[model samples]
Target: MFKKKYLALVLLPLLLLLLAISFLGQAGATTSSKSSAPLAAGVQDIVDRGVLRVGVKQDLPNFGYRDPENMQYTGMEIEIAKKVAAELGVKIEFTPVTAQTRGALLDNGQLDMVIATFTITDERKELYNFTTPYYTDAVGFLVRKDSKIASNWEALDGMTIGVTQGSIQWGLLEEIAAEKGIHFNFRELGSNSEVVVALAARRVDAFSIDQSILSAFLGKSNQLLDIQYKPSEYGIVTKKSNTELANYLDQLVQNWNKDGSLQTIYNKFGLTPVTEISD
Candidate 1:
């Protein structure tokens, strides 16, 4: 009887200890499950991948240009991209893009975002998500100094103008032509450098694009027309379904604007952003 009582006492404590350990193990598993809940799809995917793929212009100087000799990218947009990667704690991979290819790449899931001087428009907003404008600029024309083209929109009537393919400048100019009752012949080229070459070869009378972009091509042989028009706002672009990513980007832009970070970037590149233009 004493032996039976002693065994019962020992077995009772052992059973209690095992029950406590089982309860604690289940509790720990529950806590971990709650803490490991997945993030939103857009944010989670990027975090899981460990890299941020970005599309950037390879031609535009002081914005997203790549050096031919060293193959290094240095520009205001590049710096902004680096900031984004840093914020996400990921490495950045830049894919060369142009006005024509940026949207297509985003649509095909080849790029996580595009910072290639993408102009935001109502039509574009229907297709992809856009952050608030980080930079604003106006359209301008670059003409040969010796071409004797008057520095006004009216003077370009019936003359051939070179514009980048898929740029908004064509539609903007169309509207201006309709308003002024004048017409312009437009040559849509694949890239900015091609348009510049067309202008140099006199294949087109003028090369037109954002004033800041035109400034890069300006030289002793060419001059920017004295006229600027239709202020364009550039925004960071992401896939339409990535609303979470877009919101995050929008908040970053808003914070940067408020804190003068955007202006600091502009100053670093010697850029003076134009919000409005006087005719």
Candidate 2:
């Protein structure tokens, strides 16, 4: 009985050791398999799954709005994403997100990328990777030409302003107004079109949003209103770990600029193409 007990105790440790080695080997194999995948580092797993997950906003006109008649997404950024997906040889699965949640979606691995009309800023660069600017734009104000408010930035004082939620332009406009001693009340809207609707209804005195976006709205609505835009640039965004993908996109943008693809896209919408900077 003692011999039997001793034998069992000796075999138990060996069995456990074998199991530990087996687990370690499996872990090592998993790591190697992941490393050998075909997609970009940190992104192979997603590509291997055969879908490029994208976060886009359907609310923003001319950038990501969906076609009302067909319920298909057709906008400037959407076109750009489609091209990228083609190059990657993967299908695109778009996830709708608001300005407030876009960054969160990118960070959480829920999205492989974001090509929405996301403006690049110094602070945002810390949290995500930015492709080289594919387009330039600016924050601009929209007001009815017949309205009593001032036409330019200097003229806006004591007038209520309308801006969309989760827009950097909204916060910037408020600060500028406050600094200028302009007591403007800022109204938050869901989309740029809503902002224009509010202004037309006199629900708000003025609206501030991206200048190109405002241009698209004006072109479509043909409303009698004066429009203006200040200069800025826009870029694609990805999670910080997606450096390779971001760089790839930057290169693609460069090619687009050289071959007139970017200009062609802009021209299709009657938008003036901004010159690309080589640096």
Candidate 3:
């Protein structure tokens, strides 16, 4: 009976040790599983699909533009999109979008996000998620060098100013007009190129848009007015239901802003973003 009792004691400790070891192994596995789990649904979806579909502007140089000669997209926003895709370990597919088409594409589930020069506003915040501003710029006017218009906003008071259709510039101009108690005519076109064409054809007295964008179109024939107004901030846009993706993008932007990555991109493109304009 003593021998049996001794055997039981030894086996008991052995069984307990095995049980403890098994439990510890399971706990470690649980931690590993949790740590290796997939990302949020929105982000995981992009990864599973193997491609990040980003909407970017093809017309605006330096910010986002497609080279017809080489059939390639190049710009600051394009670089940003490439970085995002690399983070997700996916290839990037660029879809050319304008101010009018970007929102609709996002709503229709055709684009994962838009990196175009989309300005953030409270009203728009209700409709879609916007990351923190990546770039800021103020409104300016581009006019023919030979035009009699002075190098001031007030000079175009009564003249027709061409603006991109569906852009906020029209409303902004109206606000400025009201504040100054001056009336101005506006011609809304579909794209920046069209507005520039209108200005070249004298269909509009001035091409009014963001100064950063105007800098791309400046040449010997046209000059940007020495005025600025209503500084607007551009942000990455995602669908309203994809706050997870927006949050991720926001964090990336915050990091880039702090680490001077964005500044490096601006310098490569010779872009000087205007954060504020003096009255």
Q: Judged by lDDT against the true structure, how good is candidate 2?
A: 0.75
lDDT of 1 by residue, 182-264 (tens): 99999999988899999999999998888878989988999988888778889999999899899888989999999999999
Among these predicted structures, which one has the highest TM-score? 3
Candidate 3, 179-276: lDDT as tens digits:
98888899999888899999999999998888878888889899987878878799999999998899889999999999999999989998888856
Candidate 2 residue lDDT tens string, 1-279: 999999999999999999999999999999999996565665565567789888887866667877779878867788788888887788998888877788999988899888877888888899889888877876666677667554455566667888887787766766666676666677899877788889889898767776666666564323323434444677888899888878777888889879988878776656664443221
- Give the per-residue Cα lDDT of candidate 2 at 178: 69
Superposition-based RMSD of candidate 3 using all C-alpha atoms, in angstroms? 4.1
What TM-score would every model get versus the actual structure? 0.85, 0.74, 0.87
TM-score of 2: 0.74
Against the true structure, candidate 3 reaches a TM-score of 0.87
Q: Local distance difference test, per candidate?
A: 0.90, 0.75, 0.90
Please give the lDDT score for candidate 1: 0.90
Give the Cα error of residue 28 in candidate 1, in Å.
18
Please provide the root mean square deviation of candidate 2 (C-alpha atoms, Å).
12.3
Considering summed lDDT, which 10 consecutive residues are worst modelled in model 3?
148-157
